[model samples]
Target: MKSCQCYLFRPPSIMSISSWVCLLPLIFYTCLAVGAKPASPQNVNVLSLNTNYTLTWDWDYNSSDALPVSFTTEYIPRFKLSSKRVVVWNMACEESPRRSCDLTPLDLHYLSIFILRVRANVNGSHSDWVQKKFCPDTDAAVGPPSKVDLGPAGGHLDVFISDPLTSANISMREELQELYYHILYWEKSEDTQDLRSRSLNSSVNMVTLPNLKSWTWYCVSIQTRYDFYNKFSSFTNPICMQTQGTLPWWQIVLYFLASLLVFFVLMLLILCGSFWCYRIVKLTLYPPIHLPKHFQEYLQDSPSSDVPRLLTPDSESELLCEVTVCPEPLVLEVHQPPPEDLEEPHPDLEPDIRHSRQDSGGSNDSGIYSTGGSSGLRPCPSLSHEGGRTSCQDIYDPQQVKMKDMTPGIRSQLIIDEGVLDMSV
Candidate 1:
């Protein structure tokens, strides 16, 4: 058998100054590394709330020093031998030293226990990890569901619920599948109305309350229930709703008529606008025709048998003379006065001349013809004479007369009948 032994050597007071300086620094750093490393956290405890865990611990350190301080946390499923998982450090505890941290995202099953560990660090130095063990589902206090919504669905009220969750990704565990809903509703008035209630299954987030009075305001509230291991949540804030009653016939008719009238008015406006636009486009594309100025004047001439008074009286006599003159002269006749005993007593009376125009023959009985040829003849005037009345008659010319040289005024005045002129002037 063999054994090994070691001996200690002490430095003398006469050691060189350079050696003392280097050894002094090495000794001071060694003492600081051994004694000034941050202490492990103390009194590590877990505060388990429904679906969450709050971890807290105690530490003693001088914060005024320049030393940077922080904490690291980790958890294990149940027994000490299981591998540890680092709880993602919450942003709330990262900046400075923190004695407590909220470790959530917990799979809070009653049968599952979690072991948590926390440690402190100063600069690059770290201490041992302090450990605590607790089961969140069995230890955490219970809380109420977050909110509820109530609305009218036909003659009933539809209730909707929202529950708080510990983690973003919660699986369908048996404990989570046990939510129950209870609803209570009552009519809102002085007179008593029977209270109604309804219960719903865990999987249904919405339930309908039926058998409600129409046109009545009803108040309602809901509460949630879970396993007896957790306390029941408080009732949600109350809400009020009203059911609609049947509408009257006249009101329905009035609304229908109003809608129809509005539609008709809109259609009428659109049609009118379209018609106006069409007219504008047509006018732009194709304009109207205007008659020549002289043609318009010719159409405006008066229909008569006398010489047309074309010029206004205020016009110069030279214009009148020019209008009366013809390019070529034709034979014009004047009837001589009949003898004294045979003339008509009423000289101003004119014979009916319309029938004479249609007759084909000429009469020589009351003839006062100035020319023997058939060309020159005029209507006999009723002349005043010494004796009684003469019987009136007509004359016609069977031969056609060519219009040779009538002045413009005379041409304007001529009344044509079957290609014959009634006026000579």
Candidate 2:
């Protein structure tokens, strides 16, 4: 019965245009402040840990007026479309400026795809949710072999595997002990169906593939295995490698020795050719000297009446009178030696003379004289007249002359007047 008297409440009436103008700026500012929202988180990343996943993000406070932002995250199966959702709110990040959140006490499906969404609230103004889709086994599994080394070992491919990224958590460590490895390889030129596989225990990390074709390219992939769970992680990216070829130590040594032999032979040939060229050039540039036989004959010939007589240092008138009166021409006439006396031969000379005499018949000069050995002087057969002066002619022979110092300073003097000749005595 008392509710029948309920009265209606009404607000104050509109103010004048001048009063409204005064309140418009304050209302506008208040609306602007209330409507402003915090910027969405950027560089959102998720790191898988031994037993938990850490979600991290960053934002610039200077870019937006919204301050003191709070963050919340949600995870759901990427393929599931249920309307119901579950959220995990981070109280620590809401109270402080921390930018990270750790999700724990949950077991995620290893190979299942998941969708992660993150949103920020600044003074009850919410930002659009940032979403990411990834698989746990592919994006959240333990770190794979950090370093893989491949090399040739005794005509085989040697693969070295290490670093399965150890974990401090007891659960993760037990899982790691049960972890195995699957290795798959194939020839690059072959199809995908031609792949080959190998299973290795957890204790064995290194692998040796022997008897592989040399200089052939092969692609390889490796993945982690859980024997108890009967699960296998996604395969790692394929890596290409080539097997070593066959080369023996003896073959290398033989090659080296052959090269050295070739080099030595080439060097010897070059030296011999150079020597031959030098000999040829010397023969062409400098020739040997040889005298003709006619020159010796001319020197040995005796002068006849037709030839001019060698003039001696004597009276020309006496020689002419003798020649005109004699039946045969007077050969030569000599005068007394000059005032200058002749110096003795050098000390180095041995003045020994050897000669032989033979009777030559039917000649004015009856006896014939010839020299012997290397050094001697003798007169050849010649005509002789009745006068006291003998009419004779002698041929000079160079082999008869012997002097140790045959230098230019030493001289031999022979003088003649008409047919008459004289010698230094």
Candidate 3:
């Protein structure tokens, strides 16, 4: 047997360094002429699809490197790299600059979490696998399409074809690559539990159902699927909704009447509001009234007058003129009774009085002393004045007391004027 020795040595001399420098430009040109690829491979960027049962891969190529035309995707149920492992297909990568591919983990062993990797097939020769640790996975899928909304919405499945949902939609994203979807329906609720209904597997999101009862609520359940377990998952929350029913003529009429009534009510409110607004605008633009010139002058000049004279007892004459109103006086007559009644003549003009005298005065010798009102005594005879003013003295009348000769107004004023004081200054 012959033994071979390997030598560990440093560069011998400056001669080698000089020779290498001289050959650098020629090497560079030759590489350029031949379109030579760089020696370093681009590092693979592995991404765990957020749903985490799946993975996608991409790479940033070294500017000097040649890109591989193909890729291979693979996964392992366990963390270890061992003889027992899953190998997905090797295929051409997307032709785009940064090559990418999605790999679904093959987990027949029913792994809760798996390890995934992507490899570039450089010239039909695979590179080292780039791996993501702990890719999450579940045996679950999106629930079934909701039972058709049979209420106000049109239950026609074809309606979705015409009007696509812009806001609420069924979207497939790379992050959710671990899951897929299915739709199913059955006459019996139990049939859906087994995922055995042939009515399922629709590509469209909205489903149009058949045999739904009119004006009745139905119990419908949606089930999610888990791919690795190959089983239908827990049923989704049951949805209950009432379906549309045939409209009776009376109902249709009632609906139209109700709609018309609502429209009329709204119109009436709007009309009233408009009129109110018009009145308001008119008030603002052209006020309801304009004060007289003098009144306006007074208002503009004095804010002090707003405090009324009636509020202050010590107000001046001008305030008194503005705030006070004088009430007219009422008068009653004052009469003096005649001496003893001899049957009075002109009885209508005379007052009749019945009197009793003290016994100290004899019967005819008794002088008459009048008591009570003037109406209790006899009238005095009329006296003719030198000025030709006839004065009627009805001494016995309670209703009228003769005032030497005063007019009703003056007499009333004389009685009432005694009690009051004019404080207005």
RMSD of each candidate?
20.1, 22.0, 27.2
| Best-performing candidate as measured by TM-score | 1
Q: Model 2, 1-425: lDDT tens per residue?
A: 44544424334346666788899999999898788766888898888743457778887777566457777777766666444555443232333346776655345565577777677777777778787675655566554554566776655677676645534334343445666667766667667686665443443678876557887876667766655545555667878787767668998999999999999999999999999999999889977665565554444435333343454557455566543452432122122211112233223222343111222432211111233345333332454443434433444332244333333654644433322233431
Candidate 2 Cα errors over 4 Å, as ranges: 1-52, 56-119, 124-140, 166-175, 190-203, 227-234, 244-425
C-alpha TM-score for every candidate: 0.44, 0.35, 0.30
Candidate ranking under TM-score, highest first, comes to 1, 2, 3
Shift in Å, residue 289, candidate 3 = 4.5
Top-lDDT structure, candidate number = 1
lDDT string, candidate 3, 25-78, tens digits: 999996674654323224444443222233445454553356445555555555
Which pairs clash (backbone N, Cα, C closer than 3 Å) in model 1?
A: none
Error of 3 at 383 (Å): 98
User: lDDT (0-100) at residue 338 of candidate 1?
Assistant: 33
lDDT to native, each model: 0.60, 0.57, 0.44
Q: Using TM-score as the measure, name the better of candidate 2 and candidate 3.
A: 2
